[model samples]
Target: MIRGVRGAITIQENSEKEIIQATDRLLHKMIDENQIMPEYVASVFISVTDDITDAFPAKVLRSLEGWSYVPVMCMKEISVSNALEKCIRVMMHVNTAKSQQEINHVYLEDAVVLRPDLASK
Candidate 1:
């Protein structure tokens, strides 16, 4: 079976250091919450708000141990008026036996407002 785990985090600024740190935090949380292994990940799709241009979130994956072969892509999130800013979102597809309802989605920082229902209590 295959499933998608979602996560998002908001950074304070469009700086490479902040973006990389926030992305690294969010990805680790998602992986820990879902007990996901790098080998099981099929691919990862990352999107960032238009205001974010300092770094590619996928770059963090490259630095992750054992994630060298994991496929990842990055793109700009659709621009919407009044939408969240400085946010980074990720959708990770992985081979897993867990049901969709069993999967955990992570939302941190200001990005928690983007998915209140899934954000941790």
Candidate 2:
């Protein structure tokens, strides 16, 4: 069966380094916690807030961790009223033997506030 993992995080600033670092950390955490391999990943979709044009989070993942083969795409996050700023959200689709609930979705840094219930655990 195939399962998908969804992780989201908000950047503390618009700095390129911080954006890259936070995304790198979140993606790695989600993959590691779920035991997901690059080969099994069908695609990874990343969306960043409009203020986050400093860098594409997906590109950071591709270069930082040598995930050149894994399909990665970047998009603009929906602009909603009072929405979190400088946020990056990822949806990773991978072929897995596990169920959706079994997948570990990561929320790091300030993004954890988005899902404090799960983050607490």
Candidate 3:
């Protein structure tokens, strides 16, 4: 079956370093929590708020050992007056044996508020 794992994280700054670090953190947590291997990942879709224009989060994944072969795309999120800022969100499509209900979605830092129902307790 194909499944999707979602994750989001907030960065404290708009620098390339901060975006890269925060994206790495969020991806790692999502992969680890779901025990997903790179080979199982079909593709990754990433989006960032307007404030995080310093770097593309999808590009950072290229630095990971097995992520080079994975397909990734990045886009800018629609800006809303009261929306979260400096936020990066990702949805990873993977071939998995697990059911949708068993998939673990991750939200970190200030982004946790975006999906309170899915956040870890």
Residue pairs clashing, model 2? none
lDDT of each: 0.94, 0.84, 0.91
TM-score of each: 0.97, 0.90, 0.95
lDDT of 1 by residue, 17-63 (tens): 99999999999999999999999999999999999999989999989
Q: 1 or 2: which has the higher TM-score?
A: 1
Off by over 4 Å in 2: 64-66
Give me the runs in candidate 3 sitting further than 4 Å from their true place.
Answer: none
Q: State which candidate has the highest lDDT.
A: 1
lDDT of 2 by residue, 1-121 (tens): 7777888888778988988898888888888898887888898999998899788788777884557899999999889998888889999998998876777778877778778766664
Clash pairs for candidate 1: none
Q: Give the Cα-based TM-score of candidate 3 against the true structure.
A: 0.95
For residue 57, what is the lDDT in candidate 3? 89
47, model 2: CA deviation in Å?
A: 0.3
Ranking by lDDT: 1, 3, 2
